[model samples]
Target: MTKPAVDLIIVGSIGIDDIETPAEKREGLLGGSVSYACAAASFFSHTGMVGVVGTDFPQEFRDTWSSMNIDLEGLQTVEGKTFSWGGKYHDNMDSRDTLFTDLGVFETFSPELPENYKEAPYLFLGNIHPALQLHVLEQVREPKFVLIDTMDLWINIAKEDLEKVISKCTMLTLNEYEAQLFTGEHSLTKAAKKLFDLGTEYVLIKKGGNGSMLFTKEDTFLLHAYPLDHFKDPTGAGDTFAGGLMGALCASGKTDKESIRQAMVYGSITASFGVEEFSLERLTKLDRDQIEIRVAEFKDMCKI
Candidate 1:
């Protein structure tokens, strides 16, 4: 079969997440790197997913992605148990305590890109094994831009391998803490310098609620978060932000710094919706008009 082309290819984790909020315990649902990426990207482009799940992964979830027009041809369903995670959010909601992780089929999984997927112009490599992200990058025959997201866990445990992947990506996105840890610098400017020196042209440091900063060797841009009155869940805000940011970039048909900056604005707006409703509920319901309204509001709020 000749598969249709896509605007973006997302490579990362896909698993079942058991979430606990202060009010209740939520049973397993679909989640992980590519899940958030797929959800956000599906809104703006022809998106495809690549990840490993196990036999226990729901068929309905697969059907949902197909229904939404996301290509899941690269999704691998293995013989063992599905990847599972259990975590409880603290009272503050910004932090969480991980209770369990059974890697299941993901432990020894390897990504095999579909024949046609190798030509995607843009790629988002969600947080996963550093070595694996690099492997995917190595296989891309014509990638125009590659964005990578990583965590403190990998920076702390696999620094060298992580460095290799960081050096290869066009842009690297991380939270404030992870950026500081990666560079051993307390100041965000200094940390970004270190990252830019590592061969990444753009380094985005995300400060929760305080907003995000984008830095290059010669330029720096700061974006304020769109304020919200009610906060429900933050489990996937960063991933949602990436989705909005990158998805918009794909929509813009450009890869310059200004396009990336606009992407950040869209990302922050998308994340505001993400925190309002749990999982993908809020994001899924938001259409282009709704997002444009929020983007205008965000721009006005950030005005000098």
Candidate 2:
């Protein structure tokens, strides 16, 4: 099959992840942004990645993306060590504590888009420096749809830069807490409205167990979380959601309200799988059929 002209380009954090669970503590695969985003996006469409990794970043780790058919041409390997993070998850599995962060090459990272990736139709700007997100946007020659995610860190320290990035994106996805932090408001509705005013036509607020909400100037769609018996890992779940949601949108070849709704279901289904196991094990094991089955189940729950 002929290669797609890079359906989606993901720009965000990339590094080594060290995870700890109550039942088991391991220092294996973990990080943020690009890792989770690219892992999920690889499932539905062709994807390219942009992030910084240290020389110490394992070959096996980098090879995983290529093995999954994701293009990592934009991944930069610096002279120093790869970014490493250690975190411990509570029994609840929904929250975690950061034990350590070694920025390595990611500390002074600067993104430069690849030749073939500059014109991607779909773009995902993972949580990073908001200024960096805008830098990526400036590099994109023509992106039909751009989805950007942010965190409370930038909301507190780089609010202005965050707004600048939000002003350019077509869609913005953040957790309820981040929304509140960004807008300096406790009300989610008000926070989303503020975000809409910033520039995004659509906004998605992710709530841990309570479910996720999608808002646009025209309407609102709420997606109930798929009740799971147990969750082994919550790490990178939101980024995974953004990846799957945007992946489905890119795959559907539509940008309507209905398509965004469908993409939310796709995101929830994909994230449900992410929490079932650590890292990409559950995600990698799923084929298109299995994903469709879960997505259909989510639709049934939504009465879609």
Candidate 3:
């Protein structure tokens, strides 16, 4: 008997982290693009994760993903240590500095999708090397929609390869700094326009704390982040947002503009929960009731 294809497949990094804020420090926390993305996506859709870990990767983390019903048929474990990142966030919670990044098993991570995952209608290529993103895209069948996320490092390093990946994706997600750096446009409108020329159907620019904006050939939509006073850590926020957007889109079974817009709102609302605690602490405990209530608040904020 053949297995069923999941609603979405997320391929990216899985790691351990040491994070510090002005008030406290936490270590040995589960932190990775796939870890957060898969968790967020699982709320609205059947999600699958494809990534590489090491022998040292914790069984607890694996158990967490399993509890979320995320398909792990594509997860590979090898001999090295799991990837580990260390960062320190400033007092204002706006900017941070990277202390270190030990790419143990992640250095050579090349995602291989399971046969069931190849038929997923939605695919989120998380912030990984552009070359690897393209490799995953190749394995999947004709995807109905593909959303790719990236960082400033790729714009500075593997730009040509990154652009190739951008040309093939349905949407691209980037933060404000990366948008300017990638397009050489001070104005976000122009930056998104420049990216449109690269062949992506939509461009979503994430503005930390402030909000996010979505741009397409025909229109643009800007959304404010959910107002939250109890914020703790911002780690994995972007990945969580991407996961929410793609998962909501898949669950809706529509790739139209209006569907994409609604999905963005869900993305922002779900991500807001992640920042309320360290790592996935807040996200794992979240349920549909909390999300729906926040969605109501989001609608009230927009008056829509």
Candidate 4:
């Protein structure tokens, strides 16, 4: 079999974000599920992105991604305003208020993968409409691994479609509340089991600040968040986590339980860098050495 042109393909939103945290406020920063995910994943593997943006999208942003070697052949530039979102974070930084969300081109986004991306070895379905996620899946030739991230909005409104998407994915990632709401079970273990019945091989439950849990039929792995002295903004942390996890998995070319656990640690470390600044500011400047040092520190802290 021929090797894929890219190690990973990400299908999701690309947007500009206006953020207001307790400590500061910033507007029109580069932000989106695929943006963060692709950025994090690029540190580990060859990554491609598929998402729609408007003519108003900055050319400099495009240059930055291109410099990172991210394949943007799948990025569609239409004739409208790019998707924009505004949020205000609380002091704790674990929760936020959606000040506004202008879907713009994203509202009508129909991801169309480029011919070269059709054979990507790994795929990540970002938090987009379930129908669109399924559409992208149909276009892909064959993926060695597939993971998806979803939000509460889709769960409440388009659950039937969401479940169909879940059934086809190798892994599902969502917050703790979304997991409980989807399964109607207060215990995460039961919720994970319920999700397994939905046909996904693994379920990752994200707990902001606290940590994350990975569940498979045979084992469960718990990982703690890397402690930070201060947090600047929480925007894109979850997507960054997903990117790092998928990036590590793709780079290592492994999908076993041990590989998944190691990927989670990489995810956690990358996410800690995300919260240190707004948007992808800190993450863009990171190198493998910085990531390796942090991961080593985490191992030391958690050693038995």
Candidate 5:
């Protein structure tokens, strides 16, 4: 397959987040699924983001993403305030409470891909309404691989639409709870199989601190989460992970099993950095050398 101009195209939310962790509280930080994912993916390839932001979106935020080498052609600037989310993480960082969510411009978001982005070989459909995800799928050209991310909200309220979205994607990424919710199966293995039966070629079940599991018809791979002594924020880790996975794949220009495994490692490594600081602070300061060194350390730690 010929490579498209853009290595990866991501469609999802773009907004500011108000986060309160056990250690600190910060308001109005640049966030959203597209923000985190594009940041991670930018490390490995030419990445572009498609999302809507309101007039209130900061100019600095736009410049930051531009500096990251992300194309913002598909990022629409509309009126009103950008979407905002507020959440507080517990001491353990395992559970969080939603303080408030103001959808704002995101509530009316309708993705419209730029002409140049329509043929991108790799596409990541971020967690959004199932109908919106489906709309994106229809707009894109024949993507070499399509990955979809989902949260529990869509599972409970839009199972049928979510199922339709699942059937169209090449892979699905969701937390373990979402896996069980979708299949009504307690077993991860069973849940994965059920997802594959739904037409997705692969299923990735994220276990948060424990790790992640990748399931395909012929194989199952389990990876441990990269260890961190202190975690400042857990928000957007999943989106960061997804970005790394897709970024690595785009960089390698391969979708083989070995490539996928390496992508998972990259994903875990990126996520470890995400939780070390709030929002994009750590990620923005990171360089390729830091990421490679950490990935090597991870390989050594996992080596038997």
Candidate 6:
């Protein structure tokens, strides 16, 4: 029997990480942009993940993605070690230092989407090299909506290429610092104005725990992060938000302004749960019912 069409495709790095927080440290954890985003998106849509790993990757992690029903046909496994990173978070939980990095097989990553994924309705370019993001875009055929996330590294080194990627995406997601770095404008409004000149239809600036703000040619929208007594780890929260946003858009079957507004809230709530545990532990345990409860509770908090 033929398989159903995939609603979303996410492309990014897949890695194993050693993380040290003020409280403790863990090694060989499943972590990466694609891993976090794909898992979160699976909760709301039929998602396909495109990334490269190594033979050293654990079977149990593969089993986890399988359990989420994420399409793995685009996942490539090859010789060599999986990309690995080590980080230590400070007492504030807002700042972290990279202890080490080993590119391993990831240094040569080249995303090649499955034939079935070429026409996916939604595509998310997770934080990866701009050239790679462009490579994936070249393969996709007329995606209904495309979202691209970038970092300061890309803005500093590949400004020209990153600009091209932004021009093609329906929305661009980045932190406030990255926005200023790319546009040289201290005011976020002016920074967004420069981005709009680049041709993206929308811009979403992530403020981490403070919450997020959305910008368009005509209006701006704001969302508050779900209140938490505290969160254990924040490694993948941003990726989770991006994935959830794309997934919610797919679930709604519309990309109108109202749908975009609702999807932003869904994305924020999903990331809130992810930070409660280490690695992907909390997100792996998340279910649709739990998400619905919090989404409603969040809406109630906003009502006058």
Q: Candidate 4's residue-wise lDDT over 139-188, tens digit each? A: 99888899999999999999999999999999999999999999999999
The collision pairs in model 3 are: none
Q: Which runs in model 5 stand beyond 4 Å of their true positions? A: 1-3
Q: In candidate 6, which residue pairs get closer than 3 Å at backbone N, Cα or C atoms, i.e. clash?
A: none
Clashing pairs in 2: 17-30, 54-82
TM-score of each: 0.95, 0.96, 0.98, 0.98, 0.98, 0.98
| Candidate 5 lDDT over residue span 47-159, tens digit each | 98999999999999999999889999989999999999999988889999999999999999999988888889899999999999999999888888899999989999999
Worst 10 residues of 6 by lDDT: 1-10
> Alpha carbon lDDT of residue 226, candidate 3?
92
Q: Which digits, one per residue and each the tens of the lDDT, describe model 2 over residues 242-294?
A: 89888889989888889989888887788888889888778777777888888
Misplaced by over 4 Å in model 3 are 1-4
lDDT, candidate 4, at 300: 98
Best by TM-score: 4
Clashing pairs in 1: none
The list of candidate 6 runs beyond 4 A from truth reads: 1-4
Supply the TM-score for candidate 2. Answer: 0.96
Over 4 Å off in model 1, which ranges? 1-4
lDDT of 3 by residue, 111-171 (tens): 8888888888899999999999999999988889999999999999999999999999999
lDDT of 6 by residue, 1-304 (tens): 2443688999999999999999989999999999999988999999999999999999999998999999999999989999999999999998999999999999999899988888887999999999899999999888888999999999999989999988899999999899998899999899999999989999999999889989998988988889989888899899999999999998898888789889999999999999999888998889999999999999999898
